[model samples]
Target: MQSFLSKIKDFNNKHRKIAPFIIWIEIILIFLASIMKNICRHYKILLAVVVVLIVIGISARHLASVESKTPEEGSVVAASEEMSVVEEALQEATVEASNEASGEESLINVDSAVSETSMENVDSAVSETSLENADAAASLESTASLYVDSGISEFIKAHTEAVGWIKFEDDLISYPIMQAEDNSKYAIEDADGNDSETGAIFLDYRSSADFSDSNTIIYGHNMRDRSMFGALKNYKEDLGFLDDHKYFQIITPEGSGRYMLFAFMDVPKNSYIYDVCGDNTSRMREFLDTIEYKTYIDTGIEPTVDDKIITLSTCTQKDDLFFVMFAVKVDD
Candidate 1:
């Protein structure tokens, strides 16, 4: 009996890590059964009760472990609700800002109307008034661009490896594009070096950080959550999605610019479009021609060899297939 109890104790200790509470409950029930057998005449009843308790305890533990591993439906709903609340708040704030801007513009127009009347009264002022208004509008646009660049610079200061920010007009593709010594650094890791399935959008390892390359390549994961570059698949579902979202913006420390999307295609994993350094004007034109041919829809925007281009690539439904979108930088 001593030898048998010793072996049972060893077994319990070995499996304690896997199910601590269940092991402890089994031990207590067995001890109680042993005591009940000693006190009562019937040992079979106590033995059966202990066996039932052990089975129930083990089954409950197994169920609990499975539940812990699976994601809860309620949690997903809560997250989506929070995101909707945030988006709604942002939309309301944007509408308020637009109303305020309209109010300011109306006041400016009133001032301009009074000034025009004065200019009409004075023939000398009429000659230079239109030019002055043009100059002021240009200055305002320049100042706004400068302010946006400054904000991006401030963001880069906090995240040194961040090369630039990219955002598609009507998609959830807004993310900071990062580059490291190797492309694999951000392939499975975020900007903060945390392991993530949907990693940060990253520039190609061979591409320049300053966006000086002929064809800059950016990559992101096509997450099932519709995050990262997952929304890119919408183009395949609705061809008009491309027509509605023709432009994406990239803001660098140097300046901010827009890119007009001209083509989207699915290519093999080893396609030449992944080549960053081997591109020349002739090669780029050939590459553009191939993209134009493979594109699902003709955007009617053609690119010249001199224009700088960007390619956003992500995996498609197949592991070996890659979906890529090509766009040319629009001259500011």
Candidate 2:
């Protein structure tokens, strides 16, 4: 009996980090059962206690049966020292796991804050008509290659009238920006940059876009390595994100145009603020108004009425949905 007690004590001392967590879990289970039974008179706390005890018994039996314990014949002091090393390793692992969890939680919190701020800005900026017009904008399917490059910038295929791709930074880029809205081909890349590696989905769901304006909504995963649009999420907290990536060079097959960042706001999932009127003037005016209202910080390049626009959208760990940053086409 004394030997058994010493063995149990040694096990506890060896796995101190795991021991406390298991004990706390047991306590929590027991406490929750107790509270539920007390709140419901028909549910007996005694029965809950019995159930918990049965669970504990089964767990102990399983552990005893599954774990192999080879008794080491060594000096008692040496055994104790080995046990201490094991305990230290377990504790260090536990601490590292805890720190990782804390960091994830912080990222989630930051995402939530950014989402909330985005919605607030959108709500403050959008007109009631803007919300309603999003549906109307969806009614029209934009015809391709109508844009005649006014000699500002153009990427035409060799000896062909139709232009759907371009060469940028010495890389041949193409467009019609191949995207699979919601199906098997779930991948996107800059046809212009020829980097299918971008792994971004450029979306155009004008059930939110209210205007004749092309809503080139793009999306990318926020990878930890800053791969895809991982670096874009950095815009949530600082200028390091903003300064490094502000302008987007959109190289469609017919033309390559740049867009300057005009607005950075996170709209809610169902926010119909993307709609603009059929009347071109009204549509442009609406864009001007919303951009002016939601422009938290600028990307420095001023967007005028003539430039087409691009919208980059992504989900954050903090929110259950997404946030978007808006920019307009530029000639350079």
Which predicted model would earn the best lDDT? 1
C-alpha RMSD in Å of predicted model 1 compared with the true structure: 22.9
lDDT of 2 by residue, 21-91 (tens): 99899999999999887768755767798899999999998888766564554776687765864653453
Error of 2 at 300 (Å): 6.8
- Report the Cα RMSD per candidate: 22.9, 23.1
TM per candidate: 0.54, 0.40
lDDT of each: 0.68, 0.46
Which parts of model 1 are misplaced by more than 4 Å? 1-150, 276-282
Q: Residue 190's C-alpha lDDT in candidate 2? A: 33
Looking at candidate 1, the ten consecutive residues that score lowest on lDDT are: 119-128
Q: Write the per-residue lDDT of candidate 1 for residues 52-112, one digit (tens) a residue.
A: 9999999999999998997789998888776864653453344335435553211112333
